[model samples]
Target: MRVTPPFAPVTDHDLAVLAEQLGRPARGVIGIAARCVCGNPTVVATAPRLADGSPFPTFYYLTHPAATAAMSRLEATHVMAELADELAADPELQAGHLRAHHAYLADRARYGDVPEIAGISAGGMPTRVKCLHALAGHALAGGPGVNPIGDAALARGDWSPQRCACARPGPMLDAAGVAE
Candidate 1:
C-alpha cells in the first residue's frame, strides 16, 4: 500500500471554500483529507475534540455534497447490512478493517488524545459497516486499498471521484433549494 504524507495546514482560501460548501463555518478542521477532481475538498481531517470540548471520534469527515448524497443513497439501499455480512464471513476483509482501525487511531493521535474515544474508530469499523460516509471518507483520505469496504461502496455508487459534479460558475446549491 502507498503511504500518504501527514496533512497539510489549512489555508484561508480553503476555509472560504469549505464554508461556502458547508453553508456554515468549518470547525475543528485540521486539514483537507481528500480533494475532488475539481480541486474542492471531499474530506477533512478533524480534531479529536471540537472547540467546545465535545469528543469527535470521526477523524475523517466527508464534506462534498455530491459524495455525501451518494453515500446516503447507498445506505438507504441497505448496503451497510450486506457489507456487515461480508465482514463477518471474510477473514481478509476483517484483517484489513483492523489495520484501518489502527491507521485511523494513529492519524487522530497527531491532533490530540481524547480518553472518551480511545481505540474507537468511526463507521463501525473493524467489525461492521455502519456509516458509508465515514468509510468513504477514510477511503478517500487513505486512498484505494486502505479501506476495502469503502472502496467497494465507492465502486457501487453512482458518483465517480474522477469526475467533477459541482455546479459550474457558482455554488452547488442555489437559493431555490435546487442543486444549482
Candidate 2:
C-alpha cells in the first residue's frame, strides 16, 4: 500500500533545531532529510555531502520514510501490523517463542495461585471476560504471573531439583497410589 507521512506542520524553530542536530551548514538540508525520512518529496534529492564536497560520513538515521514522519493513529496501526507480520512468518522462531511462552504459562499455572475464573470457554464476552478474570488474579496478587515456587526460590534460595527422565523413583505410579 502507498503510505504517506502523517500530516503535521513544521515551524522554522523545528527546522533550526534539526539543522543544529545534523551539524551541517544552515542550508535547510536537515529539514529536507527529515522530510525524506517522513516519506515526503519535500527533500532536495542530491546525495548528502559535507561542506568540502565530500560524502557525508553516514546516511545518519536511515529509516522507512513513513516511520520517520509525524506519527498518526493510522500510520502507527499499519506499522504495528507490519511488525506483527514480520514476527509471525518464521515458523521455527514462532514455535520456539511459543514454546517458551507455554513453558512460562504452564509454570505459572502450576505454582501460582489459580485465578478465580480459570475455566471459562473461549467464545463471546462472558467467556472472554471470565477467562481474562482468570488470568487477572496474578495482577490482583501483585504483578502478572508471580509463581509461588519462583518467589520461594528468590526468598528462600530453594531451587528446583533436576529430574533425569531415564531415572524414576520406581515404576510410574497411577493417578492414585496404585502401581502402574
Candidate 3:
C-alpha cells in the first residue's frame, strides 16, 4: 500500500490480535522484536484521538522499524486491507463514506491479509499494473509528482508561491476549496 497518513496506531488490542495472528498467546504482551520481515527495524505507530486532552479509550502509536521495513509490498497491501476491515466495523467511523476507499480495501480483500490492529482503516490507490506507455511516460519524466510544500505547510505557514517571471502571491483557496 502507498504510504499514506495515519500509519496505523499501536493499541493494546492491536498488539494482542497481532500476537494471535502470529500464533502467539492472545494475552501476552507483544513488543516490536528484531528485524521486520521486510528487513527494516521500524514499527509504525498512530494515535487516534478524542475531544479531551487524554487519549481516547482506543490505541497508541508505535513502530518497529525493521519489521515494517521488512514487509514486502504484497504483505503491506494485505495488512492495509485488514486495517480497512477493522475500520469499517468502527462505530466512530462513518461507514458509508468508506465505500469510496475501495482501491485500498480491494487489495486487502484480494490478499486475505489481516492487520494486527482491530479498529483502523487504510486509504490508498489501487495497485493495478500500469501500461507500458504509462511506465515509459513516468520514466521519461520523474516518478509521481509531489506537492513541494506538504500538508503541514499548507495548514500553518505562509509559504512563498510559485509564479512566472514576476514573483507574486499565488491565489489561495480554489473554487473547489483546495489549494490550486
TM-score, cand. 1: 0.89
Inter-residue clash pairs, candidate 2 = none
Summarize candidate 1's per-residue lDDT along 1-180 as a digit string, tens digits: 334437767778668878877889999999988877656678999989999999999999998888899999999999888989999999999999888877888888878999999999988987888999999999999988888888888998998888887653233423332333
TM-score of every prediction relative to native: 0.89, 0.21, 0.17
RMSD of each: 6.2, 27.1, 20.1
Residue-level lDDT of model 2, residues 1-180, one tens digit each, is 111122234445434434443345343133222222122222221123435555431211312222223223323345334423434665543443333233333322332233442331111112111121112211112222332211221122211112211111223334332235
Candidate 3 accuracy as TM-score = 0.17
Task: Point out the higher-scoring one by lDDT: 1 or 2.
Answer: 1
Candidate 3 C-alpha lDDT tens digits along 13-97: 4464344333453221222221122222122221323234333211211133112232333233454344345445653333322
Ranking by TM-score: 1, 2, 3
Question: Which portions of model 1 show Cα errors greater than 4 Å?
Answer: 1-5, 168-180
What candidate 2 gets wrong by more than 4 Å, as runs, is 1-77, 113-180
Instruction: Give me the displacement of residue 100 in model 2, in angstroms.
Output: 2.8
Better of 1 and 2 by TM-score: 1
